[model samples]
Target chain A: MEYPSRLIENAVGEISKLPGIGKKTALRLVLHLLKEPEGTTAELTEALTELRTKIKYCKDCHNISDDEVCNICASHRRDRSIICVVEDTRDVLAIENTAQYTGLYHILGGVISPIEGIGPSELNIDQLLQRIENNKNEVKEVIFALSPTMEGDTTAFYLTKKLRQFGVKISTIARGIPIGGELEYTDEITLGRSILSRTAYQQD
Target chain B: MEYPSRLIENAVGEISKLPGIGKKTALRLVLHLLKEPEGTTAELTEALTELRTKIKYCKDCHNISDDEVCNICASHRRDRSIICVVEDTRDVLAIENTAQYTGLYHILGGVISPIEGIGPSELNIDQLLQRIENNKNEVKEVIFALSPTMEGDTTAFYLTKKLRQFGVKISTIARGIPIGGELEYTDEITLGRSILSRTAYQQD
Candidate 1:
């Protein structure tokens, strides 16, 4: 489509690059910004620029942070001995939102996906191993909380193989039907796994 | 949700202010941008800032433009006598994509909507009228291509009252069931209107 202005075209082009945002939605967002006060756009520009320029990852966990170490890693209340390994910062946020997991995180940045040419060496696997080796006694357990996907499982398997000699207790998150999920609606493989991995119940 | 870093929080807050973007979606987008090359965010920032700071409106039609007069209004190939009036620049672009009309555009900026506290004076209605009055007999037709909503109809009615003295032909785009639209799913009002406004078939 022919844009009346090059400025608008450029803004739309940049905005539409975002995931799940189409050309139409991008145009709507850009126009919404145009309609608001000039300060709004300025603030957005500042926020994005500062986020990219000033943003850093926690040295220990590879999570996005504003400082040398993230707040989660630095917090005294968190369980440093138990680290939940995951894909990216979003997973960290997701797990944090649950409020059930108090353990520190190990963001791999991404999974080991051969299709995408991503491997163990490209991720923060070495740092994680170093973290465990450095605090062998302090870090007692390493938990694999990655997604239930081929890539996630592959990454977890690779990590497990590397971590076998560390002598720490290695575990993975459960692969059962989700809470409030109906047995009938569950996918065949998940339902099958949920049944096969069922724990023995002891009556109260 | 608890953000690990203040910078990520700030960026998410600013991004979520955009229309149709919720906090969760905002976080996802921010994380996506963070995962991409740093230059991507920098480019978006630069584009948004430049667009807001440097974008101009056409003198003849209040459409967003790089210069004083937009390409559509200034182009010699366009039918200067016919002016298609729309609610916003998006509408102009939508119509332009159809490649059916070659007329100059008169962007109203928005329709008359009292619920949102928007009125005729807030729009470029006066400028449109002034353009017609100034052009006089040179401009022969005024087309109302705004959305077929109550506000659009009200705005068109008001413009027709003001444009009556100019002795120019006025028209509106046809409103009916959309092409390939299922009759059973069409809303009663639109279906009725489609039947009422049925045109004679000029078959080959």
Candidate 2:
């Protein structure tokens, strides 16, 4: 589509570069920004600039942070002996929201996907190994909380092989039907796995 | 959701302030930006800043433009005797893309909507009237190309009442079933309108 102004075209071009956002949505957003007060655009640009330029990652877990280490890594109440390995910061947030896991996190940044040209070396695998090696006695368990995709499985397999030599207990999060999911609608693989991994019923 | 960094939180907060964007989507965009090279984020912010700061409106039609007068208004090829009144720049672009209309445009910026607290005074209706008054002899027609909604009808009605003394012909774009629209799935109102405004059958 032809834009009336060069500035608008440029703004739309830049915004549409983002994932899931198309040229139409970008134009709508740019037009919305034009309609809002000048301060609104200023604040948005300032915030994005600060985020891109000054944002830091936790030295230990590779999760997003403002300081040398993330809060989860620094907290004394967290179980430092167990590290929950995940793909990215979003996964960390999702697991944290559950409030069931008190262990520190090890953000691998991404999984080992050959199709995407992301290998084990491209991720935080070395940092994770170093973390486990530095406190071998203190770190007892390493839980793989990555997705159920093939890439996640490959990464977990790779990490398991590395951790076996260190004599650390390695586990992966369970794969099964979601809590509220109906058995009939559940995928065959998930239903089959759920049945195979079934536990004894307990009275509440 | 808990954000690991203050900068991430701030960026998400600002981005979520935009229309249609939520906290989750904002975080996803922010995280994507973080993963990309810093230069990408810088370019996006720079473009938006320049757009918000340097954008101009057409002096004659109120459409977005790089200069005081829009290209449409300055074009000698356009029909000066006819003016197509529209809601905003998007409408102008849509009409232009059709390549059917050769007349210049006067962007109302918005329609008359009492529920949204938008009155005639809030739009560029006065400028449109002034344009017609200044070029009374040259201008022969004023076409209303607003959406087929209550606000649009109200705005058109108000303008028609104002322009009654000018002796200029007033018209509106046809409202009916769109081309390529299936009759079975078309809304009753639109189908009824199509039947009511049926034109003479002409062989191609």
Alpha-carbon TM-score of each model against the true structure:
0.96, 0.97
lDDT of 2 by residue, B1-204 (tens): 898999998999999998999999999999999999999999999999999999999999899999999999999999999999999888998999999999999999899999999999999999999999999998999999999999999999999999898999999999888888899999999899889988899989
DockQ of each: 0.87, 0.93
Q: For model 2, what is the error of residue A63's alpha carbon versus the real structure, in angstroms, after optimal superposition?
A: 0.7
lDDT of 1 by residue, A1-204 (tens): 878888988999999999999989999998899899999999988998888889999999999988899899999999888989998888888888888999999999899999999988999999999999998889989999999999999999999999998888999988998899998999999989988999889999
Model 1 docking category? high
lDDT tens per residue, model 1, B1-204: 888888889999999999999999999899888889998998999999999999898999999999998888888999989999999989998899899999999989899999999898999988988999899978999999988899999999999998998999999999998999999999999999999999999999
Q: How well is candidate 1 docked (DockQ)?
A: 0.87
Give fnat for candidate 1: 0.96
Q: Worst 10-residue stretch by lDDT in candidate 1 chain B?
A: B1-10
Model 1 clashing residue pairs (backbone): none
In model 2, where do residues sit more than 4 Å from their true spots? Answer: A201-204, B202-204
TM-score of chain B of 1: 0.95
Q: How does each model score on lDDT?
A: 0.91, 0.93
